[model samples]
Target: MKVVRFICRILLGLVFIFSGFVKGIDPMGSAIKFGEYFSAFHLSFLGNFSLLFSVLLASAEFIIGIALLLGLRMKIASWAVFLFMSFFTLLTLILALTNPVSDCGCFGDAIKLTNWQTFLKNVILMVPVMVVFLERNKFSVRYKPLGEWVTLGILFTGILLVIRYCYFYLPIMDFLPYRTGTNIPKAMEIPEGAPQDEYKTILYYQKDGVTKEFTLENYPWQDSTWKWVDTKTVLIKKGYQPPIHDFRFTDQEGNDITDLVLYDTRYVFLLISPNVQKANTAGIMQAKSLADLCHGGNCAFYALTASPFSEIRNFTEKNNPGFPFYHADETTLQTMIRSNPGLMLIKDGTIIAKWSYREFPEVERLKNDILGYAVTYYREKRESLTKTILILTLLLTLAVIKILQLNFDRRD
Candidate 1:
């Protein structure tokens, strides 16, 4: 029983930690999911607070996981975990039945689960949840309340800082289809053997002042007495879909330039803004300067947005941003980058690099040679090193705290 309890606790802790970390790293993505839920349930009034709810939920999950893994404050942590799991399990059950949102966004974009899959996952997790809850009292090790609270306070603060950094910049780890190194065209390809969607075609017809629904097999096409009212095609089963299915680029004149951009061998600088009206003006100006720099070199530049043509015209008239604005899906742009105005560098159809508005490369920095390989290589290397260091520092700090806690308890 004791071994079972230990394994259950560890398993639950790791699952919670992973779930929290993924959502925390991409809080905006979670917020968007929350908005979808609110809209679906007619509770859209709370849409403004989605981000706050997202951060708080993620933080609570992380804190509970840490407490469980480190065997700290078991009484309270166990209760919290039990309640949290119970609530979400019930919620997922409802979602599975209703099928409002396609993906629950429980693991952010790191993992995608269908409504039924999410409910099943929650149901399976209940076994460990019950085990931990039942053994909560047995693992209730006494500790100095002040010290425990202080440690949690510090940890929570660090989590908030990391979330904020990712919100302003971009997620340290990109899980979207448009992540760096992805070949845009290749990601959108559909394999020849992919399964096609299965649909049930229902025909509505009226005869003798009465309407009846019939399948295509039964529908009397030869009978002139029956009049066809409408036809409904219902999807019975979904099929394989490409990751970048929604990706497209439409110019102001309603011309498709997706292939033109993807086939270009020269480096292409793309400024993506989901909403032109909400985009930062300063960031747009910076993008314009970057566009100028690209034009001077062997590169191309274009701006893609989801805003309507009227809004685009208004924005251009007001700011005079000397770059052409194309159209793409709003959600697609959001998936590409978190920032209001983000920059992407693509070469030969591959996403070479991406940057949030705050980190837009300066014109002077690339004046020497805009397409120089060394410049992008070192930048990517530096950013990768920074992420590794930050993660290691946090882990080391937690390890030290756990060691000190154990040592202090031993002395007692």
Candidate 2:
């Protein structure tokens, strides 16, 4: 019984911790998923609070996981876990049955799960949840109430800061297919002998004021009296799809210049904005400055957006960004970067680096060589993020050790 209780507590704690951290790191992505859920459930009015819900959910999961793992406030943490799992488990069941959204976004972009898969995962998790609930009172507190809450408050603040930084800048870790170093053209390729999509064609026919649906295997091909009403193709099975199937660039005149730009020899700067109307004005101006920096350099600059031509024309006329704006898919743009106006540098179809507007390279840094500066900046940023995570982990470890030491002293 002791062993079982320990195992259940650890298992549920780690699962919730990972789930919460991943979602917290990409709060915007989680918010986007929440908006999708709201729209699908015909509760679009709640979309305005998606971000709020996203932050709260991540915080709750993280706190609850820590409490369970450390045996801090087990009474409350166990109840929280039980109630949380119950609600989400039921919600996932409905989602699986209705099939309103394809992916449940349970782990944000870090892990993709179909609705049915998510439901099954929750169902499996419920076992440990039940055990933890039943044995909640068996665990002993290691610290005073004040100490436990102070630690939790610090953790909560730390998580919120991390989320805020990621929201203003970009995600510390990129999980999307369009991450830096991905070759756009190569990522969009389909392997030879890949299975094709299998669709069943259903033909509808009307005769004598009656309509009947038939498949090609049973259709009355020879009957001349049957009048064709409609044809419907249903996808029986999905096939292999490339990671970047929906990415394309269309010029003002509706010309596909994807190949031309992707195959270019020199570096190309692409400023991506999913919606021009809601984009930050300062970011737009910063992008304009970047365009000026690339004017006579070995790089060319362009802005790509999902906004309509009218918005683009109006924005261009007012801002005069000194670069062309092309049209792309809104969802693709959103998937590419979390920032509204983000900068991406690609050369020969390979994404060299990406930056949120807040982290955009200063004009002074790029005065000498744009590519050289960008490469150095990207390397430094990557190292910085890695170091920050390591420091946080070390601090948490030290804190836990100190707490354990204090508990031993008190016992002595």
Over 235-260, each residue of candidate 1 has an lDDT whose tens digit, in order, gives 99998899998878999898999887
Deviation (Å) of 166 in candidate 1: 1.2
What TM-score number comes out for model 1?
Answer: 0.93
Whole-model lDDT per candidate:
0.86, 0.87
User: In model 2, how large is the Cα lDDT of residue 102?
Assistant: 95
> What does the lDDT read for residue 286 in candidate 2?
82
* Each candidate: RMSD: 2.3, 1.9
Stretches off by above 4 angstroms in model 2 are 407-412
Q: For candidate 2, what is the TM-score?
A: 0.95
Q: lDDT score of model 1?
A: 0.86
lDDT of 2 at 337: 88
Model 2 is weakest, by summed lDDT over 10 consecutive residues, at 403-412
Residue 6 C-alpha lDDT in model 1: 88
